[model samples]
Target chain A: MVNTILIMAGVLMALGILLALFRFILGPDVTDRAIAFDVMTVSSISVIALIAYFAGRVIYLDVALVYGLLSFLSVVVIGRYIERGL
Target chain B: MEIRETVGAAVTLLGSVFIFLGGLGIVRMPDLFNRIQAGTKASTLGTILSLLGLAIMNEAWIWKLLVIIFFVLITNPISSNVISRAAHFRGTRMTNKTVADLLSDKNKKISEE
Candidate 1:
């Protein structure tokens, strides 16, 4: 049952990624792409957590945390650059 | 133990569904602010729930998961605010249906004095 649920969750997240990717590709603007990227990163973090669960390793949670921090930094930098001349 | 796994799986599934809805909003919303509002709220909740679910399933890793959750709770809104402000300053136009812009109005009021 746990395995089935995880598989279903993966499929749903995959569909989410596909929609976000569509927006990224069809971008009428750069901000749209940035938003899409943000969504993708968040979803990928969840995926990484799932991977950790599957592998029975506690280490990948650290990977997920780092990934989240880096993505947050990148998004903030992008927003700052877009807001001003940086 | 069995009950714990079942409950955790249900929560995780719900979180995944929310994340998917957030993606749909990001793609479907007509304006930048609208997209930001929709995507940020849903995704933030989705991420928190996902991590919480994971932590529930794996009791030993709860602290690390909580840290990740706390970080996400702090950063998601800040990033979204920055993005929306960038869009505003860059003169990203709203859809025709937008009735008012309080930020611009406040700025105008301050500049007048």
Candidate 2:
């Protein structure tokens, strides 16, 4: 039953990611593109966590965590650049 | 066979759904500010929830996941705020909305006075 639920969640996440791709192409500004990039980061993190669950490996969880933090930092840095009249 | 496990599973699943919706919002929204609003607040929280679900599944990795969540909570809003302010400062006007031009008009009035 838990596996069934995990699969369900994964499917939903997949659909969401596809929609985000749409925004990436359709967005009218640089900031919009950046937002789409951030969304993709979040989506990939979700996929990583689900993969960890299916694999039942402790290593993958930690990897996903690290990746999430790194992506968050990158977003911050990029945002800062934009804020500084870029 | 266990209720706790079921709860964990449910939380994780729900988190996944929310994260997905956040991504959808990113793609579907028309403007930069909208995407930033949707992506940062919604997706970050949703991702953290998903992390928590995984943490609950196992005991040894819970602490590490908490650290990641902490970082995400701190960074997401700050970054989005910075970007939105940049967008505004750079004069990326909303394409299809009517807003009273108070700032410019006030500047002009002050200049005249």
Candidate 2 — which residues are off by over 4 angstroms? B98-113
Candidate 2's residue-wise lDDT over A16-45, tens digit each? 777777877877777776777777776677
TM-score of chain A of 2: 0.85
Error of 2 at B82 (Å): 1.8
| TM-score against native, each model | 0.95, 0.84
Please give the lDDT score at residue A27 for candidate 2: 74
Candidate of highest DockQ: 1
B1-113 in candidate 2: lDDT tens per residue?
36666777788888877877787677656566666776667778777887788677665778877887787777677767777776776777664654565665776798999
Collision pairs in model 1: none
**Candidate 1: misplaced stretches above 4 Å?**
B106-113
lDDT of each residue in A1-86, candidate 1, tens digit only: 98899889888888887888998899788888888888888888888898899999999989998998999899999999998868
